[model samples]
Target: MSGDHILETQDLTREFKGFVAVNKVNLRVRRGTIHALIGPNGAGKTTCFNLLTKFLQPTSGRIFFEGQDITREAPAQVARRGVIRSFQISAVFPHLTVLENVRVALQRKYLGPSFQFWRSERTLNVLNERAMELLHAVDLQRYADLPAVELSYGRKRSLEIATTLAMEPRLMLLDEPTQGLGIEDVDRIRQLIKKVAADRTVLMVEHNMSVVSSIADTITVLQRGAVLAEGPYAQVSANPAVVEAYMGSANVELQGAH
Candidate 1:
């Protein structure tokens, strides 16, 4: 519950029926810092995110956000508390114009109980302006008027980030933001994430080591549903267990040497 930490988990565990997916996890995310969670497939990275965002409730653990316990909060409730998540797949509304899609997301942030379409034109325009600012922040302003369905794959991902920014989250949970991106696109997204995390906390599940090393202030290596090592990039990558887990013994010392 320290002010410097935006998120803290106390023995966070998630189970499916009788099987434990995310074992007792104690994660700490510093305020305004970018933290990367990396591991091989089935390492419980995504499940941890689900527990934080309330997409899945932990079987027996507590999640604290900004010093408040929110373990049993619902997904929408967690989001309203300023903890938002962006999925791996693009979640933009394909039929809507790019600008319109962003505007809709912004509206959702402020609408609360009202129906936006039924509101005044001025109100909608105000929301549109805010959305445009978010779009430009993510470098999708040029495609504002284009139908989202027609945007390139990378552009669509940018739009998704823009939409999430419209929510004005204090902490963002990014699940493989660069999963299918090419090298160039991946670099762009990495830079965007760095920019976004400058004044906010970001906890991302990224498999790309280069991307993680470039942007992450700290990296947590997870294995078999538990944290194997957590520290700065150099420290965690140098851990014998982490090196062995990723590339066997061959690539271990070599990567650490760098």
Candidate 2:
């Protein structure tokens, strides 16, 4: 693995029974960049993500992170090495206040294993300033005192990002940060993603081509469990095989990126 690449997969494959969901994928994500993994449904994007996070072991090949082979590491082990997946892995609890939610993740990072409910309030308060800072980074500082369940879907996503931020990841895997939101919220999350990627590497599996094109430093297109194209938006979007795989109106969405 090169120093510039924060994450690398060497011919990674995953098989479910006789079906090959992710087949021989070779991905190299550069440090401090936003890389987008996109494909039509059942293209194995999610499977690839699961493999990267060690949520699913690869049937063949290897995964390397920061020059070390991490193929056999457990999910928690990989996470400790600074790969944090938001939304799923760093979920925000609905009952906890936004600040408290972030504090829980901080507790995991600063105080070890999560949900240390018996810890002194003074010890937990030690994390509040940092939690507020993370909340501010995601533009959710004003919602710190509010219950997470009352937040709008977009705000909830922001809170999730804030919690993920508390873990201080070197590589953040965002799964559809803008999946369900109005145009205004979509724009807000898009800008937030760019801002967050400023100091760390981001690898995301996103459906919105416009979002991918707008912020992704590199885009990888997957089809039928394999990589079809990988490059900047302009290059991959113009590839004929990529266009054909997208098939109908999705081609328009791809071109719309231009």
Candidate 3:
């Protein structure tokens, strides 16, 4: 990993039984840029994400963050290295107030895994100021008092991003940030991703070609677990092989996305 790139995978590969799910995938995400991994369904996009976060270990090859070999690091160890992942599904503490959810993350950050819930309110109050700031960053400060469950689906996703932010990640791996979103929510999350990427790096597995075209600085296309094309949206989208390998009907959508 050079100073110009925040994350890199050297022939990263994963297999299930006898089937190869990810094959010799070399990914290089530049520092402070929004990078996207895209392909048709079953292109091993999610599998690649799991490999990076250690949710699933690779069968071969290595992963590096800022040049450190993290191929064997545990998930917690990976996260501690400032590599945080947000799942495809909205992951929020439904019962906790929006503010409390972020505070819990802050507690984990400041107090470690043994964060004291039994501590005095005065002690915990110190975390509220920072918690509120995280909420404000995601535009959820107005809903601080409400249970996360009460929020619309889109807002719940926003809360998830805020909590991820509280972890102070150097590289955020977003897994389909707009997976089930409506048009409006998709737009909001797109802009939100771009905003956060201004200071830190982002590597995402996104299906929406429009979002990727609009926000991604680089796009890597995978086909049957291999890199089919990798470059800016314009360059990748123009590749004849990319157009042929694009997820069926999405080929039309990809063209229109531009």
Candidate 4:
């Protein structure tokens, strides 16, 4: 693999009771780029993600991050290595205020399970300041004092991004970030994602072609359990295989529209 890639999977495969979910799939994500993984349902996108994040063990093949082998690492070990994932559902603490949520994330990274930091008012002041900066990064500073659950759905997603950012990930994996949102919410989160990705690499699985086309520097199309196409949006959209794969799918029609 080239040195430019931040993450790479070589001949990655996963099987479930003889059912191949990901079949010898090789994926490369360039450093500091926003890459999107798109495919029809049952295409093994989720399985591939679980494998990369170490949530599932690969039946065979290897995963590497920043030139080091991580295929055998535990989930928390991989996360500590700077690969973080955001779930489809917002991961915010519902009862905590937005600011408190971000603060908790910061604490987890720096304080671990030690409660001594909580006893130090001075340390908390420092953490709060850092948390506010992250909240500002996601445009959630204004909602810092509100309960996390009180924010709008889109804002909750923003909060999730803030919490993810607090972890200071090198390669961020976002799963269907803009799903089930109104037009304005979608647009807002799209912009937020672009902003956060300025200094980090992002690998996202999204159903929204418009969002994918607008932000993804590279696109990888998965079909069945293998890669069907990989290129820029324009190139991948024009591939006959890609067009045929999405032919009957309403959501993917936007991808081939041009």
Candidate 5:
């Protein structure tokens, strides 16, 4: 294991009813790098993310984070170790204001498992300052008082990112961060991701090649649950196998780097 890597998987494999969802795959994410996992429809990207986040236990293999073996750790335990995952669906509370949602996340981190519901208003008020800072980070300060459900699709995703940031994770695992958004929203989220990755490590599963090329420091191309190629955008984009994997996709061009 290299000292520079924040996360690594050794022959990570997962199976469902005799069907292999994630094959024997070894993955490494360097510290403070934005790494992307891209592939065709059934490439096991989600499964791989699940395995890393401990949402789904692997059938075999091991996971390591910050030089510690986390393969057998629970999801919450992994999260406490600074590995957090954001889902494809926005995880924000529908009725809670954006500021309140981020405050709740901060509460979880600071208050711990024995959090009391009857805590005084002053206690919650102390978290407001930090929560607003998080909202500002994701450009959600303007909508801080609005209910999460009232935001546009892209704004909801931004709020989700803000809440995740409140956890102060060392490695963030994002599953399809830009899925289902307009071009303008996609661009906004892309910029937000780049900004966040400046201070932490991010491993995301993204299909949009343009966004991947624009923000990813390293790209891992998967095919049928196994890695086909891994390198910088310039190298992986020109790989013959990667090009053939996305042969018919009009939007994904494996010849250019953004």
Candidate 6:
């Protein structure tokens, strides 16, 4: 692995009993770059993500973060090291107010307060200010006072991204960020992601070709748990193997349209 790589996998593999969910896979994400992973459903993309984030341990090979071996690191430890994941599904607390959810996330960095205690008015006020800053960054300040469950689907996802930013991550893992978003919401989220990624590295699993092409600095096409191709948007899109694996015969027609 190169010294400058922020994240890398060497022959990473995961198995459940006799079945291999993720086969030998190697990946290298450059520092401060947006690297996208694209693949079809059941192509082992999620499995590879789980293994990298330490949600599941790899059956073989190693994972390195910041040039250090972190293959067996606990998920919390990995996250604390500035690598955080924003789940595909909303992970916010629906019962909590939007501001409260963000404050909870911010307060987690300081272990002095018990999770059960309602923060003092002064402390809450400070946390609320910071939460609003993050909310505003994600274009979610207007919904900050509402109950999280009452927010629209797109807003809920925005809240998730805001909460993740409360941790001030150096590297972010995003899973299907634009899924289920309307065109407007998709555009907003895409811009929000780019804003957050200005100084941090973002590794995302995205299926939308338009989204990938718009945001990805480099693309890795995965198939059957391994990388099929890796390059810039135009290069990967033109690769015959990648086209067959994901875009299918229609890719030729799509390319013609472009």
lDDT of 2 by residue, 87-168 (tens): 5333578898999998988998678786787889898998999998999899888888999989998888888888888889
Single out the weakest 10-residue window by summed lDDT for candidate 3. 245-254
Q: For residues 1-258, what per-residue lDDT tens digits would candidate 6 score against the true structure? A: 797689999999988897887888889999998999877677788888898889999999999999889999999889888889988898989998999898888887753435644557676676777888988898888887799999888888889999999888888999998888888888888888888889899999976677778888998878778788898889988898877775553222315322
Every candidate's lDDT: 0.85, 0.89, 0.91, 0.90, 0.91, 0.84
Clashing pairs in 4: none
Over 71-115, each residue of candidate 1 has an lDDT whose tens digit, in order, gives: 988988899899989998889889989998887787776777544
User: TM-score for each prediction?
Assistant: 0.92, 0.96, 0.96, 0.95, 0.95, 0.93
Residue by residue across 46-89, what tens digits does model 5's lDDT show? 99999998889999999999899999999989999999889998
TM-score of 2: 0.96
What lDDT tens digits, residue by residue, belong to model 4 across residues 131-188? 9999889888899899998999999998999988888899999999998889999999
Supply the global lDDT for candidate 2.
Answer: 0.89
Between candidates 2 and 6, name the one with more favorable lDDT: 2
Q: Runs in model 4 with CA error above 4 Å?
A: 113-123, 255-258
Residue 57, candidate 4: alpha-carbon lDDT: 100
Minimum summed lDDT over a 10-residue window in model 6 is located at: 249-258
Order of all candidates by lDDT, from best down to worst? Answer: 3, 5, 4, 2, 1, 6
Clashing pairs in 1: none
Model 2: per-residue Cα lDDT at residue 181:
79
RMSD of each: 2.6, 1.7, 1.4, 1.8, 1.5, 2.4
**Candidate 4 positional error at 62, Å:** 0.4
